[model samples]
Each structure stands twice: as structure tokens, then as C-alpha cells.
Target: MATQTSIPASHDRDFYAWALESANRLRAGNLAGLDLQRIAEEIEGMGRAEKHALASHLKILILHLLKWRYQPTLRSLSWQLSIANARDEIAELLEDSPSLTGKLPEILARRYPAARQGAILETGLPAATFPTGCPLTVEQLLDPEYWT
Candidate 1:
């Protein structure tokens, strides 16, 4: 699908070339030009990206749940679908990285306030009405049977 080219000198200059070069070096057992430091850093960055994604999805899930709870009369199929989708995403993330289970509670706590704010912005609800702290436990939020 594409032409092969010489590896770029620096990873910063061309990331695609850098990755290809790194892989080629590793496969060829040529450690001389292999960027071990940058490769390790990139690996760690990928893990952090996944954690951030989990946090982001958790925030969105809680926001929709708050709206569903606080604005019962305004609930719609879209909100239902959003909650289900978020749960599904969260499950997939946990399945891929089960160590994240230990961080779930703290993540939920950290994201809850922002989620409430989002709920207010989206629903036109006053901030005073929502709980100061998270109302749903992480388990409850993740439970498919919990929402009615």
C-alpha cells in the first residue's frame, strides 16, 4: 500500500518512520540504533492513554446517569443508549486491563463532580440539585441491572 523509505534520524521528526525503524531494529537484533528509551516511554504513554480513556468514559457515563436520575421526566432513548454504551466501553477497558479494577473507586470519585457539572450544562438543571458527592457507587454505575 505504501513505499518504504529510509528511517528518519529522530523519532520527533517522523514518528511513523521511528516506529518502523524500531521494530526493524528489534527484529533484526540490531541494538546499535534501537531507541530503547523512547520505546519504553511510548509503551508507558500508551498505558496512560488507556487509563485516561477509561476516566473520560466514566465521566460521560456518570453525566448521563445523573441526567437520567435528576431529570426523570426528560429521559429519552438517547440517554439510555449513552449509559449502555458507556458501560459497555468500561467493561471492555477493564477486560483488557484488569489491573484498572483497583483504581475504579477513585476514578469514579474524581470524575463525579465534573460529570455533575456536565449534566447541569446539558440538562439546564441548577447545580444545587445534584449531590455534592457521587450518588452512585462504582459498582452500581457498572451494573447492567442497576438502572431501570
Candidate 2:
């Protein structure tokens, strides 16, 4: 059997405080939990263009957070700063890549079909007609060539 050590209550409280602060920032930016829920509904209703936009934003945010928090080598404050900087660089690449911009929604839809459907419906956008030009696909995003 595995034993678990209890974390101090103060540590839990501090963690909650930091999480709340982050949530507040997201809310102030119109990206609250409720807003995200609404966006999920909108995804089902959205036209292809709107769905694509939302998907792109979501991906960028996820990638940014991953880069910021999960870099294997960044254990110290300075390395963490480097992670943040790398996230920014990744953001820039996403913004500038036309191929990626087009396929964002398809990637999301394939990756999270239910959530994508809900978002389209909530956004009140018409059904999407995925264009042929988009470079990102459900498969491609999952197994990215660039990353490989």
C-alpha cells in the first residue's frame, strides 16, 4: 500500500489564493469559467469561421500554459522566466502561421467533439464548411510534424 503525506492547511490555502487570483485575471479578460462554458455552447452554433477563431484562441492558451508550467528543465525561478519567454515565442509562431490559423477549429473539433459541438451551438454560428486550405487536421495536430 502507498502512503500519502498530508499537505499543511496553510499550503493548501495559499494555493487556493493564487488560483483565485489567476481566475480573477481571466475573468477580467472576459475569459471566466462561466464565459468558457458559454463559449462551449457557442461552438456548436458557430459558423466555421467563428469556430475556427475560438479554437485558435483556446489552443494558444493551452500551449502557453503548458509551456509556462510544464517545461522539464525549468525548476527554478530563472528557468521559469525562460519558460514564459518561450511561451511568448510559441504564441508569436501561432499568430504568424497561416496554415495553423485555418485549421485550429478542425483540430479542436476532432480532439474534443462534444465540447466543440457545444461551443458552436452556443456561439450561434452557422454550420461550418471546413475549407480545403487549412493545414491543420485532427490527425495532424495530434501528431505534429513540426514537433516530431
Candidate 3:
């Protein structure tokens, strides 16, 4: 019988190796739909260290998705890339500094306090009225009265 070990199998392999292999496979030219659930499960099973190594690779994957989905301009792409890099750096910093985790709640509260309640107006706006003269705008130009 195999003994149960606290150390998971993913930890047995070097994180860089696993991350690189996973990224290479993901980046390989393929048009077929991916099994996202299965891929997520596989990543979830990885050890903490592996997860950290994989963050950068995952960031790249997200950037690719953003680029494809939005077809952003080069300037927009550069800005987004910078933001992604900053996010990855923050993740690395948090992972390396475990002590920061303890103060996360306080830090978050300080950075973003709870939303304040605001009173809502119950009054409704009056219906809009069109100008008496012939509508010069496209919307008015298309009106039946303008055509008549």
C-alpha cells in the first residue's frame, strides 16, 4: 500500500519545468476549443511554489486573450501589458512576503473603504419635446414630418 504524503506530486517536480511545459503546450498553434475546466483543475492541483511560477505564464495567457478579444491599438496593448506586468509583480511580492497576508484586510479597508449609502430621488423626469422647426439633425431629418 502506498503511504499518504503531505507533499503533493506537483511539488516533486521543479515549478519552472512544469510551468514552462504547460505554457509551451498552451501556446502551441491550435484553433480547437480548449478544455478549460480540465486545465484549471490541473493547475489547481499544483503546489504553492508551482502556482507562483505559473502566475507569470498565466498572465501572458490572459494578455493573449485580451489582445484577441479586444483587438486593441498598439498603444492600448502597451498600457495593458504594463498593467499585467505590475499585477504579476504584486503577486510575486505577496507570495514571497507571507507576513503581508496577515495585514491584507486592513490594507484593503484602508485602500478601499466600504461604499457609503446615498439617498435615491423618487421624482421622474418630464417627457422630452422636439423643436417646432424642421429637425436639422439626422434623427429629425429621418422624421416623417421632415419628409412631409
Candidate 4:
């Protein structure tokens, strides 16, 4: 039998090594060997990452929708593809973490202002061109057919 080499739990030095070691330690039933604090932090960090990703994709999707609706003359394949890609990514995230679906309304509401500003900046349109609040519903944002 090959002896499994153990890695040091130094999160600051080598996170990849630490993660691998943590998993190995966990599989070996060595709870005492685990870096409890760091592991907890990493787990929490993962949830935060998922939320951040959801927010980012939502922002991009909203930004593109804004552009598509307000700047019809400037529409391109890129914007359409961006909208599709963001939706696909968000769908995948939700599929993997259904619990996040419940958080969508809040995430969208929080992310919309930034997306609206992004649309303004990208479209070179006045802030007034876009609604102060998101005009699209969560359903419309996710529905592939809504804007098409």
C-alpha cells in the first residue's frame, strides 16, 4: 500500500495544498488533524463566492438586457450571446445550489443599481435613459424568450 503523504495546513502559504490535505485528512477520519478554523472559513468563503458569482452573472444579464432594450440600434451578436451566456451560467448555479434560488430576489435587487450604472457607462447613455430601478422582473430576466 502506498503511504499517503500529508500536507501542512498552512492556508496562507499554499491554499491548494491545504485544501488537498484537508480533504485527505477528512477522508482518513482524522477530525483532530483538520484545521477547523480555516476549514470553516473556507466553507463560508465558498458560499460567499457562490453569492458573488450569482450577483456578477445577474449584473451582466441585467446590463445586457438594458442595452438590448434601450440601445436597439447598437445591438450586436455579442450582446445577445452575453445575455445567453449569463442566463446559462445563472441557471447552472441555481441547479447546483437550489437554495440560492430563494436568494435571487434579494441578489437581483441589490445588484440592479450596479447593473444599471454599468449599462449607462457601456452604452454611453444618460442615467435617465435607464430606469432608476430594474424594470424587468426576475422571471423576465431568466426567461430566454422574454426579450428575444
Number of the top lDDT candidate = 4
User: Least accurate stretch of 10 residues (summed lDDT) in model 1?
Assistant: 5-14
- Whose TM-score is higher: candidate 1's or candidate 2's? 1
Output the lDDT of residue 140, model 3: 26
Error of 4 at 11 (Å): 1.5
- Give candidate 4's error at residue 134 in angstroms: 0.8
**Candidate 4: worst 10 consecutive residues by lDDT?**
5-14
lDDT (Cα, tens digit) per residue for candidate 1, span 1-148: 9998864567888887788878887899988867788899998998998899899999989998888898899899999999999999999999999999889998988888899889889988788989989989888989988774
Question: Which tens-of-lDDT digit does each residue in 1-148 have in candidate 3?
Answer: 9998653223236656545545655799542444456457766665454544434333332333233233333335654554455445545655776554454444333322111000001112121221222113323211223211
The whole-model C-alpha lDDT of candidate 4 against the native structure comes to 0.91
Q: Rate residue 38 of model 3 by lDDT.
A: 49
Worst 10 residues of 3 by lDDT: 114-123
Indicate the TM-score of model 2.
0.22
In the range 1-148, model 2's lDDT, one tens digit per residue, is 9999844223245745544555565668844433455345545544555445545544543332333233334345653444345445435556555466566565555535443343344334343622223333434433322221
Q: How does candidate 2 score on lDDT?
A: 0.44
Q: Each prediction's Cα RMSD?
A: 3.2, 19.3, 20.8, 2.9
Candidate that scores best on TM-score: 4
Off by over 4 Å in 3: 1-75, 113-148
Who is ahead in lDDT, 3 or 4?
4
**Higher TM-score: candidate 1 or 3?**
1
Instruction: Estimate every model's Cα lDDT from 0 to 1.
Output: 0.89, 0.44, 0.38, 0.91
